[model samples]
Target: MATWQCVKQCGACCHLDPAYRPDLDEYLSPEEMELYLSMVGEGGWCVNFDRTTRECRIYPYRPRFCRVEAEVFEDMYGICPEELNDFAIECCQEQIEGVYGDRSLEMLRFNQAVGYIYKEG
Candidate 1:
């Protein structure tokens, strides 16, 4: 059977400036923002991203954009096919499933409600 994995904690997705996202910060509650802020740092990368290692510190709590499907990644991020791993990256599939396992509906609703859905920038 196949498994899933991400880009080894690559911070590419988190590199975007939250400066343009005051609406983003306001999208969540103060408590949620505080908890999330405790994890973001320089480069607007998630605080979990260790600059030296170029990896996410809090992989487990990473948001949906980080959990993107491989095809969606290439299509949405313009990553070439050769630059990505296969459909399921195997190594951490179980870990991802553990988090998003049976929460498909919840995830969809929450993301939609908060405007976390994708759009071309």
Candidate 2:
């Protein structure tokens, strides 16, 4: 079975483009929405993301929305703990592909880290 794991140096999730996530109001509370919007920087990337290092500047203290924990996923997206692994993998795959391309190094690294073998078409 495939499991979900974050690959180091892959900041694809840092591409916090609100335009890409139109349902922000649906999942996030008003305060969280405000904070989320505040974190967005130029080109929709997260202000806390370090482009030079490709990592989150405030990783240890990142908001609940930025975490991938099963409980957090359940609260945010109604994804059960049993389903978290697969769900997270799919989410990461789509987000990584959206932020970087499907063929991008970030996607490759994420897939590899998760033991996913995506075929190029």
Candidate 3:
């Protein structure tokens, strides 16, 4: 695994996901999703992101998406060939396929079906 460090409370990374994804309810309980929703605000930003003070409201309660490197390592197949293995554990198609088989492929298909990607013309 590669090493990483958070640059204080920049909140820049949080902008990636924007709002508390509704799809989270599928994986997490309704109560947990509610807690996350409580922290979401305008511009789809986490409610914990304070625009005035430029800080986090509940850093302790913040979700794992806020800490992505670790999440990617644990949740995903631990592979991102394009990034030179910076954001996640690097693994070739052969290596990953041996371990994850179709599980990761199913997840990718699900994300694609659920509009996990954004695009514009």
Q: Which segments of model 3 are wrong by more than 4 Å?
A: 1-3, 16-38, 68-72, 76-85, 88-121
Report the error of model 1 at residue 8, Å.
3.1
lDDT of 2 at 95: 92
Task: Give the per-residue lDDT digits (tens) of candidate 3, residues 21-81.
Answer: 3355554556756666665566666666776775777778666644445444455334444
Among all candidates shown, the one with the greatest lDDT:
2
Q: Sort by TM-score, best first.
A: 2, 3, 1
Considering summed lDDT, which 10 consecutive residues are worst modelled in model 3? 88-97
Measured against the true structure, the TM-scores of the candidates, in listed sequence, are: 0.37, 0.95, 0.42
Model 2 alpha-carbon drift over 4 Å, by segment: 119-121
Clashing pairs in 1: 4-93, 39-47, 40-47, 48-57
lDDT (tens digit, per residue) of candidate 2 on 14-110: 9989999999998999999999999999999999999998889999999999999989999999999999999999999999989889889988888
Instruction: Report clashes for each candidate as comma-separated counts.
Output: 4, 0, 1
Evaluate all candidate structures by whole-model CA lDDT and list the values in order.
0.49, 0.92, 0.46
TM-score of 1: 0.37
